[model samples]
Target: MLKYKLVSRANPRKRNEKQFYAQLTGVQTIKRCDFLSLLEKRSSMSSADVKSFLDALEFELMHRLANGISIRLGDLGSFRATIRSVGAVNKKDYDQRKYIKGVNVRFRPSAKWMREKSKTGELISFETVGKA
Candidate 1:
């Protein structure tokens, strides 16, 4: 049976709107727990710790991008700053001069994720009740 069906069976009235929304949004909402509780759950660390780690990683990537460096996250893709020259046209001789003042950015994903995503074929569609 589908996961949603199981959930609906367990709660016929579906009183948990928050849980339903979280499921639809594809985001997990973990409850707050102590370090010992996390260890007991075999998670290695608390949810707060995991969130902090992700924030730190994002900050580091932003810093690298600011310094004009490309960051490649494994299984993700590649990010890099692209520098291009914009030319200025002179009305007198119609001569064009190129000026360079590049922009910094970041790229991630290492091709493996793309291959995996391609294997999924096409996406399934669903209908929304009140939307035409």
Candidate 2:
């Protein structure tokens, strides 16, 4: 479930007019240990083994993304690196190393995550919990 609140802001051009929008409220967070425990129960692996695997996975993902490679985790999803840059007048004058203003990580969810699982008992259910 998601929680949201109605927020109001004054227009920059017309300060007399106020605009309203929905803002996400407090969201619950889960810890890495929780995932480790879940993996241990779902698979034949121990919590320590799952933790080690996860640690290695994190390191490898960072290493691969730094090298300009996107990773596809099959049913999970894919992760890639992106950059925000200031524009240049000409392509020949553009410098990637200097023009890249910021770097960001992008995650694209898999098909299962992007849609309902049909009759496979895979479905998403959510309810709003009012405001924060």
Candidate 3:
């Protein structure tokens, strides 16, 4: 389970007001090989086969993203290509090389992972790993 600790912080708008918030703690990184092994255990394919498939998936995903295509991975959500750039006053004055800073990939989580609450307090949906 994901672990977290309660941290007390003063409210930005009110210095005297303070509240406790859950903060992630003791986080650990799972390496590629470990991740492949976990996948291998869940599926019939071996870790090497899983790695090969993932490599191909990465290549194809990058190619499609580079071509300005957005991809949706079901419950995991969608990924799209994005660019960071400075605004130009006019189209004629805009220079792609100068105005465009860089290209980046953006990921949006699925609705299942998002928190939802109704005004009437009728329904609320969320996921919690519990406090640390």
- lDDT (Cα atoms) of all candidates against the true structure: 0.54, 0.82, 0.82
Which order, best to worst by TM-score? 2, 3, 1
Measured against the true structure, the TM-scores of the candidates, in listed sequence, are: 0.43, 0.70, 0.68
Q: What is the lDDT of residue 106 in candidate 1?
A: 43
Residue lDDT tens for model 2, 2-67:
556777788888999998767767878889889789889999888888999999999999999999
Ranking of all candidate structures by their lDDT, best first: 2, 3, 1
**Top candidate, metric TM-score:** 2
lDDT of 1 at 130: 25
Choose 2 or 3, whichever is better by TM-score.
2
Q: Model 2, stretches more than 4 Å misplaced?
A: 6-22, 91-97, 117-123
Winner of 1 and 3 under TM-score: 3
Per-residue lDDT of 6 in model 2 = 70
Give the clashing residue pairs of candidate 1, or none: 76-109, 76-110, 77-108, 77-109, 77-110, 78-107, 78-108, 79-106, 79-107, 79-108
Instruction: Give the clash count for model 3.
Output: 0
